[model samples]
Target: MYANPAATNRFTVNAFLNNDQFACVDGYRLEDTVTEVTTPTNQPLPFVFNATDDHAAADALRTLSHSEPGDEPGQKWPAEIRSLNIGDVVQVTAPDGTVTHLAVDTVGYIEIETVGAAARPAVHPHTHA
Candidate 1:
């Protein structure tokens, strides 16, 4: 019941057991998790996003990262965040100078994702620098 067996033997780890972590997403992550939602679909997901080019993005990131379940995730944004479920494309510039753009997608944490998706988009453009 395994895919590869070269290392760790299924011990790869992160915040949650059997999970993985990353310092950045396309190197643009300026930034989850209860089973609060019981929806059968993943459509119209909630998300808060901002480019790393501004201070507001950093603020939004801080608010989101520090938020916990049962807390108002959307109420703490820094006004530079965006909420969209259309899976719009986001561009991120890696620290190594590589640029990549990807449509919004999530790995897990539906509950928190819902909160972010429902948050309001900022009044300005959120594309990264």
Candidate 2:
């Protein structure tokens, strides 16, 4: 079996049978029993976003910090982040509870698919899961 490294929660396998009788080498019927197996390694860890800013920016950040359903099943955004403007400072909380302060040096926006077609300020991080 071969698994895709980028897949977060799924498995894929290819198998070949030796004979057309659907029998195991030991003469047991393949469909008569169930076999269970575990993955050799755990799945990849997910990215966490914890940002804080002043009133308006913080509200915008929180509003955009969400995942929208994709066309494919089980598909979703890996992190809760959005574009940010220059000079905006935000405090991010790590998974271990350690907090780090980050300053936005670039401008970013999140597009909204509305009748008027509007965009809002966002905080884009360097990395996402």
* Candidate 2 wrongly placed segments (more than 4 Å): 1-83, 107-129
- Per-model lDDT: 0.25, 0.28
Model 2 Cα lDDT, one tens digit per residue, 39-120: 1232322222222322323323323324443212333323433322333333333333433333332233221122221111
| Model 1, position 6: C-alpha lDDT score | 27
For every candidate, C-alpha RMSD to the true structure in Å? 18.4, 24.6
TM-scores for every predicted model: 0.23, 0.22
RMSD to the native, candidate 2? 24.6
Pick the TM-score winner: 1
List model 1 lDDT by residue over 1-129, tens digit each: 774432222110001111013312331121211111111241222223323332222223333434422112333322222332222233223333333333233431221122333221221222322
